[model samples]
Target: MLQVFVFNIPVESGERIGFSTTLLLAITVYMTIVSNRLPDFSYLDISYLSNFLLSDVTSGILLIICVIQSLRFYHAPVMQQFPKVWVPDLIVGNPYGSNINLAENGRVVQFTNEGEAVWQPANVFEMNCVAQIAYYPFDMQNCTFGFLPWGFGVKDLFFNVVSQELMNIYFSPNGKWEITNTRLYSQIFYGDQLLRLEFTFKRRSRYEIINTVGPIIILGMLQVFVFIIPVESGERIGFSTTLLLAITVYMTIVSDRLPDVSYPDISYLSYFLLSDVTSGVLLIVCVIQSLRFYHAPDSQQFPKWVIYITKVCSKWKQKVSPKDKQHINDEQIVNSDDIHVPTASEEEEREAPPINWPMISGCFDKICICCFTCICMIRTIVLFVMLTM
Candidate 1:
C-alpha cells in the first residue's frame, strides 16, 4: 500500500498541493483493498523498495529535482498569470556632492504568493545640507534623506526601517563635522508615505580655528599696533592701509569656505568682517591724526586740548619749559624770538624746525588703542555668548 501510494503521487506546487494530497490518499486505500486478496503477502520482497526510496544516491537526486522543480514552478507562467501590484523602492542618493560616500544601487522589490510585496534598498546616502555660517565654525546643522514610492499611496504601499539601529553602524566619521544625533521617522506627504532619516551634526572647529580663524584674529590684533607708529615717521598711513588690505584678503579666504545662505546665522566670519571694517575706520583716523600735526605755520598755535593731551603724553619724555607752559595757559603764543620770521626762501634755508607732531600723534595713538581694544573685547564676548546659547 505504501509503495503504490508513493508511486502514484508526484510532488505538488502552489494551488495543486491539496488535489495531489487527496489523490495519494485514494491510491493508498485502493492498494490496501487489492493486497487483502493476496495470500502470503508477508513473503513479498519489500527490500528492493529501499533502493528506490531510501538510498543516499536516490535521495540526493530526488532532493535536487525537487528544488529545481520548485524554482521552475515558482516562476512559471501560471504563477505570473495572477494579478500583481507593482511598487518601486526609492533609494536616496548623495546630495552633498561629496565623493566620500558609496554609490546607491537601485531598490529591489520582492513578491510573495499571497499578493504581498516588500521594497528595501541599501540606505547609503550623504545628503546636501544648507550651512548657516552666522555662527560659522561654531555652527550646528541638520540634514535629512528620505524615500517614497512614485505612484503608490499608503494603501497600496508602506515603508519601514529594517532596524532602528542601522544608522549607528553605517555612519562614517568625518573630519569637518561630528554627528551629534540621528532620527528615523515616517510622514505622509501628499498622501504618500515618506520614510526619512535625519542627522544633526556639529562643526569640528579645530581645523577652522587653526587654519582660518586663528590667522584672522592675529591680523586684527596687528591693527592695534598701527597706532604705535609715529605720525612724524610718515609710516602710519601706509601701515594702516596695508593692514586693512591684509584683513580684506583674509576675509575673502574665509568666505570661500562658507555657504551662501539667505538668512544670517551667527557666524565667526561675521565677526571677522566687523573687525576688518573697524580696522579700516581706525586706519582713516590714524591718517587724520597724523595730518593734524603735519605742517603748521609758527603763527598757527595748537588747539588748547591738543596741547594739553600732547603734554600729558610726553610728560616723561620731555620737560615743559616756562614758555611752553605759558603758551598752554594763553592758548595763543607768539614767540618774540620769531617776530621777524623769514620769507619762504629764508625759511627753506634755515635747518632748524618747530611744531611738534610726534607728541600729538602719540596722544592720538593712546586714545585709539584703548577704543579699539574695548570694541574687540566686547564683540568677542557677545559672539561667545550668542554661540553658546
Candidate 2:
C-alpha cells in the first residue's frame, strides 16, 4: 500500500508544473522505447545512428518548417528595432565553402562559420541595363546583375558567385536575343563585397533582316530607277518626291521601335538616313537638270565641251535621207498653208545656230544614268561591309 500527500496550490501555478512534468515523462518514455529497439552494442553502428538522428531527421524537420513559413508569409514586411543583436564582422580570404542560389525576387546566401555577420537582413539588386547597338540588326550585348549585403561590411559577410551554370541553364530564350555566355565574379565595391553575374547575348538577325532591312534595301535600289524615267514625261519630280516621303515614313517607324538611346550601334539605320539624304540631293539635281533642258531657248549658246558631248551622244541618230527631208518639208508646207515661204536670209539665220537644245537635254539624261549607276554600286559595297563586320 502507498501513502500520498496532496498540497493546495494556485490554479495557474499548478497547471504550469503539471505540464512540465508531463513533457519530461513523455521524453523519458521515447528514449526508453528507442533504446529497447536498438541492437546489442557490439553489433550496432553508432556513427550511422547518430548521423541519421542529428543530420537527417533533425535538420530535415527544421528545413520543412522554414519552407512552410516562407511560403505562408512571403509578403509579410519585417521590421528591426534598435539595439539589435551584435554579430561579428570579418572578410573572407577564400569563398569556396559558400553557396548561393538565385530566387525569383532575391538571392539566397549561405556562408561558412569562418566569417562574422556585420548586419542582418540586407538586400542587393539589379535594376539598370545599358545596350550597345553599333551592329544594329546583328549586334551583341553584355548585361550584369549584382548583389551585396546592404548593412554588412566586407568583414561581416563575404560575397561570391558559386555557380554560373545555374544562371545559364535557367535563362529563357527569346526570338530577338540568343544567350552566348554567362560568367560569375566577385569584387569589393565601395567598401562592400559584391557578387556579380554577367550574361552575354547576341541579336538574332533573321527577323529584322526579313521584316525591316529587306524592304529598305529594295526601296534604296528602286531610287536609282527614278532617273530612268524621261525628263519630258512630267513624272520625274513627282515620282522622286513620292519615294522620298515613303522612305521618311519607314524611317519613323523604325525609330519608334528602337529604344531612345544616344548611340544605337546599328549601322543599318545610319545607312538608311544617309541614303535618304542622298536621294533628296539627287532629286534636287534632277529637278534642276529638267528645268535647264526644258526652259533653255534654242538660241542659247552652250559651252564647247557640252556641244561635243551632245554630238557624241547623238551619233546613234540616223542621218536624214533626201527623200525623208522632202517629206518633212511637205508636212511643214501643209501645216503653214496661209504663211509665205521663208526667204534665203531667214533660212540662213536658222541654220546659223551651232548647238541644239533638245540634243543637249538627251545627252544630260545619259550622263545622269551613268552617275546614278555608279552611286548604287558604291552603296551596295558599303552595305555589304557594314553587315559583315
Each candidate structure's count of clashing pairs? 6, 9
Query: RMSD to native for every prediction?
Result: 13.1, 16.6
For each candidate, give its TM-score against the true structure. 0.60, 0.56
- All candidates' lDDT scores? 0.62, 0.61
Total backbone clashes of model 1? 6
Cα-based RMSD of candidate 1:
13.1
- Per-residue CA lDDT of candidate 2, range 1-389, in tens? 00011112233343433433444455456555665677647554564554444443444444445444544443333432333344333322323344222222232333323343223334333345677766677778887766655567788787655565544454467988888887888879889887676778899989888887777777766766776677668787777777777777778777776776775445566665567657667765876675587669977778888877776665434233322433365445454677798898786456444457766776677777677767767776777677678
Q: What digit string (tens of lDDT, one per residue) describes model 1 on residues 1-389?
A: 22223333454533333443454455555555555554535565644433333343344445445545765765654323322433364544335554322113423455565566554445445667666666777888887776565556899878665654334665579998899888888888888888777778899998877987777667766777777765557777787788788778877777677765556454656665666677677667766755666554456678888776665555534444433443356767778987885797674446223337555665667777887877766666775676667
Cα displacement (Å) at residue 103, model 1: 14
